[model samples]
Target: MLSALRKYLILPKLIRLSWSAPKNRTVAWDRYWAGIARTGARSDVLWDSGTDHELLAYRDVLRRHFDPSLPIVDVGCGHGAFSRALTAYSPRVLGVDVSPHAVARASGESAGVEGVSYLARDMTGPGAGAGLVGSTDANVFVRGVLHVLDAANQAALMENLRQLVGARGTVFLAETNFQGNPVEYVSHLGASLRSIPAPLELAIRKLPMPGHFGPEELARAMPKDRWTLVEDGAATIETNPLMDAAGNSRVPGYFAVLKAKDPDAGR
Candidate 1:
C-alpha cells in the first residue's frame, strides 16, 4: 500500500522536480494506467477512451462492415470496454491485454456479458517468436496500442497479428501521431493527467513503432496483398468535426479498421 502511494504520488512528483518532458512514454504506461480505477470524474474514462472522434467513427463503420459475431479479438483492450460494446451488437467478443491485472478486473466485473471475455497474454503476437496457437472467426484489432511500442516491436506485433489473421482476416488499428498532437499540447486539457514531449511526436512520425504509420502511412505498412485498408471504423465518440473548439485542441487521432485481402482466411 505504501509502495503504491509512494510510486504513484510521491515518486512521480520527485521525478517531476527534475522532469524533462517524458520523451519515451512506452515506459509512461507504468504510471498512467495504475491510477485509472472507477473513481475519476470522467467515470467513463476507463470504459471509453479512444484516440479521437474520427477513430471512434472508424470503429462504428467497421462494426457495420465486419461481422461482430465472428468472435472479435481486441488486442491490448485495456478494460474490455470496447469488447463489451462489441457484445451489444455481436454476441461473442474477447479482449486481451499485456497486463494481467487489467484482464482480471475486466473479466471479473464483466462476468455477466456471457459472450465477452478478457484474458492475459504476452500480446506481442508472433515477432516474439512465441506461437500463440489459436485463430478467431472474425477480425483482430490493435486499437490504442501501437503508439506505446518502439517501431521494431510494433512490426513484430503486426506481423504476428497478420499470422493470427492468416490470409483472410481483418485488422483494426488506432494510434497517436505525436508529431501533430504532442503531449504538451493536450496533456492537461480534459481527463489525462500526464504530459508528453514534443520530440516524441516528431520522432514517431520519422520513426514510428512497428507498423506505426501516420494516417496516410497506414497504407504502406499493411500493403494491399496481406491486408487492404478498409475505411475507418466508427468509435463511441463519433462527434461533429466542427466541435473542434470543444475538443482537446492539440492531439488528433482516428479509429480505423482493415479487411484482409482474402476475407475467408480468418474464418
Candidate 2:
C-alpha cells in the first residue's frame, strides 16, 4: 500500500526534482550507493543477481582474448563484484567506482584478496584516469555503465578508458539494450504500475534512468579510426530473481571486444 503509493505517486515527483536539479550523474550515483550501503543489503540491488553465472559466461567469452599477465580494471564496479571475478583472468585487478562508500564497501568485502584493490574515481570528470596512467597497458571490463550517461559523459568516459588501456590493452564492454521507456522496461521485467518491485523502486527513486546501448551506440563512442573492433555479438544481462519468473530475470544486452588502434598507424 504505502510502497505502491511511493513508487507511483511520491517517487515520480521526487525523481523529477532530482532530474531537474544541477546534480551531476556522479553525485546521484554516489548518493544511491551510499544509501544502499548504509541501509540495504546486496540482495536489495536489482541488477545484482546474487550469482556468478553471468560472470562465468563472460569469462568463457574473454578467455581467448585477455592476456593473463596484464592487469585488469573493472570500471563502474559496484562493490567489486566483477573485480573479484577478474582475478581468474589477470594477476592484478582494480575496481573503480564514483562512490566512496561503494569503494569502502568493496574494499571491506575484498579483505585478504591478493592483488585486488578498490578506488573511488569518477571516470567522467576532468583528468579522471590520470592517477591510473601507467606503462603497462591494462585490459578493461565495463558492464551496464555507458547507457546511463548522456552523450558528453559517454565520450568523457571513453577518453578515460583510452588512458587506462593505452595502446596495447583490450577493452570489453557489456550494456543493457532495453528498447523502451522506463515504465515499459519495468513492466516487461514483471512489475505492474501499482506494484513496483523494491529494487526497481530504489533505482527509480535514486539513480539515473538507464538508456539503451547497442552496436550503433558503441560505434559512435569508439570510432573506427581510433579503435579496432575484435568481436561483438548478442548477450544477456542477468538480474536478481523475480518472484514469478522461472529463474533470475534476464535483459537483452550486447558485448564488444575492442583494441585501441595505434596512433602512429593512422599518421
Candidate 3:
C-alpha cells in the first residue's frame, strides 16, 4: 500500500519532470566540458545499464545511411561509448553535447578512435559542426536526446538538425518512446527519471514525470521533406542493465532510424 501510494505521488511529478529543465541542479551548460577534461571521458554513472545490441544497431544504421569515410555527429553524445564503438565502422565520427562535462567525457573516451571527435553545443543553438549542415558530406545522430526536451525546444532542435542534414544525410533518433509509465520507465528500451535537470519548484510547476515522444510527435515537430522515419521499434522489459548499481531498473524504450527523406540526396 505504501509502495502504491509512493507510485501515485510520483506520477504527477513525472509529468512535469518530462518537460522542464532542472533548476537547482544547474547542469553547468556553459562549463559542461570542463569535467570531462578532468575525468578523461568516463562511462555514465547513470547508464551502466547499456547493451551490445543497442550499440550494434547504431553502428548498422551508420553503415546503412552514411559512408564510414564521411563525418557524423552524435548529438547529446553523453559518455560517447557509442561513438567509440562506431570507430569499427566509420573513419570519422564526432560527438556533440550541451554539457561540458558530457562533451569532455565523450571526447576523452572517443579520442582514441582515428576518425571520431567531440564538441560542445547547445541543441537549440548555433553550428553544431560540419555534420550539422548535412552538406552531402556528413550524417548526424541525435540519439537519446531530443525526446527529453520540451515540444518547442524539440522542434527547434530538429529544425536545426534538418538544416544540417542538407539533402543527402541521415539522422537516427532513438528515444524513450511514450508507451511506458511516465512515473516508472519509458518504453521497452528506456525509462523515466525522477531526478532531472529541473529541481523542486520546476518539478512542482513543470516536471512531475519522465517522458517519451508520442507517435507523430516527431512528424509534428519537424518538416515533412526534412525527415523520413524509416524504421521504428520498441523494447520492453521488466528489468535490465541501465541504471546505477545501487538504483537502476530494467525498462524498455523506443528506437527509430531516420535518414534524410531523400536518402540519395543527403549524399
- Give the TM-scores of the predictions, in the order they appear: 0.64, 0.87, 0.69
Tens digit of per-residue lDDT, candidate 2, span 137-218: 7889999889888778887887777776776678899899887766556665666545656776677667777888889998
TM-score of 1: 0.64
Off by over 4 Å in 2: 1-23, 37-42, 243-248, 263-267
- Native-to-model Cα distance after best TM-score fit, residue 99 in candidate 3, in Å: 1.1
Note the Cα lDDT for every prediction shown: 0.51, 0.76, 0.55
What's the candidate order when arranged by decreasing TM-score?
2, 3, 1
Clashes of each: 22, 0, 46
Report the lDDT tens digits of candidate 3 across residue range 1-267: 785445455555555444444342225333323422222212223332345456664555557766555567778777776677666765667777777776666766655467777776776764343344345455676655666677877877776675566655567676656454544443222222344321122323432244566456777776677677777666432223433233434344556666555434423
Q: TM-score winner among the candidates?
A: 2
How far off is residue 198 in model 1, in Å? 20
**Which consecutive 10 residues in model 2 have the weakest lDDT in total?**
5-14
Scored by lDDT, the top model is 2
Per-model root-mean-square deviation over C-alphas: 9.6, 4.5, 6.1
Collision count of model 3:
46
